[model samples]
Target: MVTWQNIDTVMLDMDGTLLDLHFDNHFWLEHVPLRFAEKNGLTLEQAKETLMKRYRKAEGTLDWYCVDYWTEQLGLDIEMLKQEVDHLIAVFPYVVDFLDAVRSKNKRIVLVTNAHGKALKIKMDRTRLGGHFDRLICSHDLGLPKEDLSFWGELQTIEPFSKQTTLFIDDSLPVLRSAHAYGIANLLAVIKPDSKAPAKDVGEFKAIQSFRQIIPA
Candidate 1:
């Protein structure tokens, strides 16, 4: 639950918050592995096992979300691969309505994402959701991931907002926890980030299944 009247800034995550995570989930889990297997002459299972291990190593770090880093590490044209599957990128249910509702109330909507610049451009090009935001930020620009506490401070230097009056919505619990630690008063979690996956059990934080749940009447 959120008090819209008290909130002035809405920091949204792109991949899992505004956009359905199915495309990303499938891209990394299925498509990437398949291509890696083909390029490396390994079996699909072997490629998945190898890539998953590497992914875990970079978990919670900016490298995990960097297309350039992955491209060099995996010897694949990561950006090109994303374009091949750009058709799958999609906005979630009622996201536009919620954006419109926030705009109508004159709230500042900022897309604060951990997505790499290349990935962000591809998604925004397909969805055209950039026009709805007051500012668009990629963690890459700040040289820090949203999971890092320092990122919040760096973000404030450019796009200022009261920590207590801002509502940060994200699908990643770790990122939300970092924001909480940085003193962001309002936090909301996406219960179901991936349309193809099951709902997550988010403890403590208020969770929403869709943006429709928070849209003002």
Candidate 2:
């Protein structure tokens, strides 16, 4: 579905695109709510119910991905909480091979993530995948979420990529839609971001279950 010959820049998402999304899914849906419930003396169900409402409200916004915002809003040390589950962090299958293949082709590989700096550091420390990328960009650095079309414009000022020759891959459909609207020539979606969760239906955009499908042997 992609024309590799026409692509010069490969923009990748971290959490679900390169790394398994299970850690994040478990953290927010189970771990955080459990801690919140224990701290407030509420039942786990109550905590999840309350937190899910808040999460839905912030969906597609920078606040949804900001550790500091959640920490302050929830009155909990979000960074420390992530560290507690750091062992769960993992890269997806064949991701390393895909990176190697892309690099072998002399493509500019960049990580464009909405993950907060603290979370990014934790995952990088655990996976040691930082050395493979040309640049690491966090949405927090630009004060704009990838869901916002303007984020592409701001990103260009710093990274200077040609929209007609760049390929962007992300698990979040909203972010992919934003990138598409910004005129990114190629867009791919992750159908199975969270390994523990069921596959997703990414309408219109091409989707892949594993990076092996895109990388040559």
Per-residue lDDT tens digits for candidate 1, residues 1-217, read 8899999999999998899999999999999999999999999999999999999999999999999999999999999999999999999989999999999999999999999999999999999998999999999999999999999999999999999899999999999999999999999999999998999878779999989899976
Global lDDT of each model?
A: 0.94, 0.94
Clashing pairs in 2: none
Q: Whole-model lDDT for model 2 versus the true structure? A: 0.94
lDDT of 1 at 11: 92
Per-residue alpha-carbon lDDT of candidate 2 for residues 1-217, written as tens digits (9 for 90 to 100) = 6778988999999998898899999999999999999999999999999999999999989999999999999989999999999999999989999999999999999999999999999999999999999999999999999999999999999999998999899999899999999999789999999999899989889999899999943
TM for candidate 2 is 0.98
